[model samples]
Target chain A: MELIVPILAAAVRSGTPILYATLGEIMTEKSGVLNLGLEGIMLIGAYVGFIVTYNTGSPFWGLVAAFFVGMAVNVVHAFLCISLKANQVICGLAMTMFGTGVSSLLGRGYVGETIAGLQAVALPGLSSFPVVGPVFFSQDVMVYISYLLVFVVWFLMYKTKFGLMIRAVGDSPLSAEAAGISVSAVRYASTLLGGGLVSLGGAYLTVVYSHMWVDLMTAGRGWIAVALVIFAIWNPLRAALGSYLFGGVEALQMRIQAGGTTVPAPLLMMLPYILTIAVLVVISVFKGRGRMLGAPSALGLPFYREERE
Target chain B: MRIKVEKRFYITKWQEVCIILASIVLAFSSGALVFHFLGVDPLEAYKMMIDGSLGDFYGVSETVAKTIPLIMCSLAVALSFTMVVWNIGAEGQFVLGALACTAFVRYLYVDNFVVMLACMGISALLAGGLWGAFAGFLKARWNVNEIITTLMMNYVAILLLQYFVYGSWRDPTSLGFPMTPLFPKSARLHQFFSTRVHSGIFFAVIIALILWIVVRKGVWGYEIRVSGQNPKAADYAGIRSTRNVILVMFLSGAIAGLAGMAEMAGLHRRLQPGFAVGYGYTAIIIAWLARLHPLAIIFVSFLFGALFVGGENLQIAMRLPLSSVQILQGLILFFLLGGEFFRNYRVSFISRKR
Candidate 1:
């Protein structure tokens, strides 16, 4: 019981960045554009965020810069996949490569640099509560914002009229166009918004989590976030839960390694990826039976208006 | 006036060349903008890159040595991509191949040079093939997504390699660095006098030639192309796509495994953590850039090898990050992907109809 609070706290802290990425990808996938460049975008965001904060001395400005950088990168993706109607998979992979290369190149100067990170804020009334307070309320401002963003994304995805348009576009762009919805506009906006959120997640890693710059620091977390969207069946609330679940596994691995357990550290590090694959297989096995198979029908397909049946 | 885009039945060769040239120019200009932002002269840096990679005998030899693995891995990707299997686990398979080769050398200890080399080669092929076949089996049996499964397997293979390198395989005399003891002299590949270029290049060419002939002329090749273009049509014609996917994936993994064996035997002569850097990932780009043609892959791989060598030189000469080359590669791929779209569809400026 004594160890549970710290573990849970670490879970939330580590999970927040993934939550941000998963939520962002959820939005993008909901719009029927699978941007596989999340890992690369996050890397660029981390670099830009760290550089901005290092120069400006404010994490706020750093996050703002990251958001713009991510959007700029995704704009290239949208132009290729949307306007030109290129193969989405290959284009997405290219975007990731570009992001990773450009970020690593530009971030060379900032290696090992340190800055003041965002501090955890204690809520006045909630501070007195024991396990729940420390685990949930006593994280950095970004963590609280992530909690809010989860519900915000959920409401935006399921509640709003705009949400309806995104689903319509994803499910059938032709049908949506027939109803006067601009499929291209919705995809562009969603992809950009998703990019912004992913960048914010990257900023959080630099400003709040690591508080320093490193190349390839996101380290495949973006890929895991992509898998998380599938695991959550594209629901934002489930995405939050899934991200924390992965975070819990990551935290447990660190704690065990620190505790001097006999298990090899590399083996422990393989947990999340192995689990992700297992879950993907299970999802595939149970596919087409019910609502559990929640992939967007038109996901990963390029939209074309003139093609005949 | 307005612009109209229409799909073309076939793009002319001259137009294709023009599009490729235009993409190259655009990519270079963007790279130049980046270089300018970083306070370096783009032309000077590019000149240095060329000189560093291909100017001297030493540079040329290094580039050739690098091309061995690139050629093998690119062929691996191209073969599976021919069937649309998406075997992104070549990196993992490569590592496993290296590990398998190392294990045979370290534990089996055959004295005859020819037999030992043969054993290592076969071990690598079998290990890589089996590893690849696992993903193919999953896809065949359960309809799983090969992209994610293969990607996940890459991490597993790397971690498994790390476990051995850091644990029982660590050389006792090396002062605690995470590496295995060097293989015996007989186990090493025969290199040309005073240069790193080894017999692996010969093996690569032979294998590529074999694969090219098989893919172009063999019955299996016909079946694969048929299944890839239209699986339902192939099914109607009595072609079994599931068997083809598994077989193609195994062969693909085997070729990548050979790449791993080549790198281990030719370059390092010992197992190390960072032995195979991003060759497998880069092969994906090379395969696409070469249009999945094995013969074209060889020349493309050499060009990429030069780019990698030049990237390393940039770190020393201009104080630029080695990732500068990666950025250039990425930009080139982006332009190429975009260019493929324009190749299929021609955009023309037409007067607006009133």
Candidate 2:
């Protein structure tokens, strides 16, 4: 019983970064573009976030810089996948490599740097609550923003005209075009927005959680976020649950180690990835491929408006 | 003014060649810009890269050594990609294969050279193939996304290797290093005349040729093509797509595993840290650059192997980071994808209509 609060709080803390990435990916995938380069994008964000915060002593600017740089990197993906109609999967991989390479090159001089990062703020009315107070309300400001973002994204994806256009373009570009919507514009915006949010997710890892930078420090969390998109069935609400569950697993791994068990570090590190595959298998079995699971119909496919029959 | 993009039914073979050449040129020029930004003279850096990787016999020999694994991995990736099944787990499969071969050498070493080599080769192929077939099995059975499964397995595979190397497999005699003891003399692959080159080149070349034939001329090759382009149609025609997926994944992983085994037995001679150096990911770029053609894959892999060596040279000579190789790869792929689009679609500028 005593271990419960710390574990739950750590779960929320650990999962917030992935939650941000998952939400961003939902928007990206909802608009029918698969950005598999989240790892590279997140790394770029982590690097930039740490660098900017280290130099300027403000994580807010650090996050803003990371977001912009990430979008700038993703624009190439947008141009290639949308305008040139190149292979989406391959182009996404290229983006990953580029972001990884560029960030590493630029970040070489900034290794071992640290910054005073964001501090936790207990929510005004919610801090006195029983178990939920310490678990959810007392976190860095970014976590609160993420909580707001879930609903904002949910509302944006389901409530607005732009959201309708994104869904239409993702499912059937020709139909959206016939309805007087610009498929290219919507896709470019969605991708740019998605890419920015993904970077923010990366920033959260550095500026909120770790307070420092490391090379490829997001590990496979970006990939985990991508998988969580499948588990969430493309819904914002479910993404939170899935992210926390993953976070709980990771937190447990850390806590078990802190408790000084005999298990090897590498074996424990393998748990999240193994669990990713396991949960993926379960979700895939129940979902039975994409269409039933509400996957974007044109996911990973290029849209060519000129030649369609 | 506006540009109108139109689909062209056919492009001349010469034009296709030109597009490919242009993409390579653009990638190099852009890479030069990066060098310039880094305060290095672009031309001098390029020259040094060329000279360091291909100028001397020693450089060329190392290039050849690197090309061997690239060729094997390229073929492994190209084979599965030919059928549109993404085997992103080649890196993992490669590591898994090396680990398996190490187990053979560690526990079941024999005095005979051929027997040791055969045991290593067989174990690697089976281990890697089964690991790959595991993903293929999930994909074929429940329709799990192979990309995520394969990608996740990569992390798991690397961690698994770390467990072995850092834990039980640590050499006791070598100052507590995280490596198994060096194999007996019989276990080493035969090298060429005083060069770093080993018999792994033969394995790479033979596999490339065999895969080229198997993919191009065989009946199963036709089925593979059909299944990739249109699975529903293949299913209607009574092609067991699931069986094909598993079989192809097995072969794909088997070849990659062989690459891993050869890398250890021929080059390193012991399983150690830094064993998986991303030849698997580089092989993806190689396969794509070659358009999945086995012969072309060899040619491209050779060039990438040179780049790999050249990047190493840059770090030593020009004080450039080795990540330059990854950047170059990304640039080349971007240009290639864009070039392919231009190849199939002709864009012409026209004044905006009033």
Best by DockQ: 2
How close is chain A of candidate 2 to the true chain A, as a TM-score? 0.97
Question: What digit string (tens of lDDT, one per residue) describes model 1 on residues A1-309?
Answer: 788889999999989999999999999999899888888889988888899999999988998899898888899888888887877777777777888888887888788999887889987788569899988988888998999999999999889999999988888888998999998999999999999899888888899999999998987788888888888889999999999998898888888999998888889889988988887778767773333466778887788777644
Write down the TM-score for model 1. Answer: 0.96
Clashes of each: 0, 0
Please state every model's RMSD to the true fold in angstroms: 1.9, 1.5
Each model's DockQ? 0.64, 0.80
- What fraction of the correct interface contacts does each predicted structure contain? 0.68, 0.82
lDDT of 2 by residue, B1-354 (tens): 988888898999899899999999999999889768856688988887899889999999989999999998889888889889999888998998999999998889898999989999999999989989999999999888888988899899999999999999888887988998997888889889888899989999999899889899998988998999998899999999899999988998999999999999899988898878789999999999898999998899989989988988988998777787788888998999999999989989999887
lDDT of 2: 0.89
Candidate 2 DockQ category? medium
- Give the candidate number with the greatest lDDT: 2
